[model samples]
Target: MQDDALFPLLSALAAVYAAEPREEAGRTARHLLEAGPSHLGAAHANDAILAEMAAALAASDHPAVQAILAGAHLLPWGDNPVAAQAAAAGDIYVVCTLMGPDGPIPSDDFRMGLFWQRPGTYYALHSHDADETYVIVAGDAEWTAGDDTRLRGPGEAIHHPSLMPHAFRAGPQGLLALWRWSGDVNTHSYRMLPDPRAVAAA
Candidate 1:
């Protein structure tokens, strides 16, 4: 039987990403759809892999399955160590990796990364698996390049090549963008800047 219990979890992830850029939303949505529902594996509490998978499915809709998922809940990366740094220079961020369904059964051909924004913040200079793209929504956002800076408003799409240097800042108000990856999610590159503060101050 299909793991219908995972449906609600997919819904929660989708809800959290409702305002994401089209590409990001599409990437994440595709992952969710692909993940579908599955038994996961032989039950093992405290297993790091199993734990993360359960957290990803924690928000499931099916009551019974949700109960199983409810065993532990790790809120989206916030000011938390693993994530605080991701949006610290900025205001919001959400990155989703296929942390569940173990083995070739739940393979990681690609991953989803979505970021939320607050005005006066920058996602900073960094790189990650696959080339990157963003769909802008909500407030205005500015992307900076070594030679120039481009400011974009709602409904605009931007692209960056793999290992290329790029950064972003929300305009006068909070912003939201969906970020999609074209290759392996585990791959990442971060540009070295003389001053991270400069990136933030910009």
Candidate 2:
């Protein structure tokens, strides 16, 4: 059945995090494996943007990437109104939390999911109390945090300390990354910073 597809992706993603050397990421991963899966409602499905990202992930040979692609459609997809506006300007972003408050699989302390952005898009700076990590599954991107900025590629990972303002721009090929959040998982605490691009010019 279609619902059964999430388990493999969950398993593979948890395995990757479990093997991670970072204590917080590893702890969250282990907890995710133990939490099991949840049935997402119809609200989670967004066929247009998600379908395209899923296809890209499915083309990968990585087990975790392919597993997530298998069930991407069934998972809940969400977007920010401001970010959606950028989509109207030809930039796009789609996210689905696998665990935690907004995700299908609910948990008290951790959140995990996928984030997809179209080519030539900029994610503008944002910050949160929860520590976060992203494992790039496909494509490349230039990620920025304050004075720090680096180009990242598939199979690479980035960690952002809690409350650190950060953002990233999708490359010509776009970007698809698996992300996780732990500690202070309150979604209300998420805030968008002043546009760094604008701040620089001023």
Compared with the true structure, all predictions reach lDDT values of 0.47, 0.72
- What are the runs in model 1 whose C-alpha is more than 4 Å off? 1-29, 36-107, 145-148, 195-202
Model 2 ranges with Cα > 4 A deviation: 58-61, 79-91, 196-202
Model 2, residue pairs in steric clash: 44-76
For candidate 1, lDDT tens digit of each residue in 115-164?
A: 44555656666654356666553456677754457887655667776666
User: Which candidate's TM-score is highest?
Assistant: 2
TM-score of each: 0.52, 0.82
Worst 10 residues of 2 by lDDT: 81-90
lDDT tens digits by residue: candidate 2, 143-185: 8866689998777778888989888888876788888887887
Best candidate (score: lDDT): 2
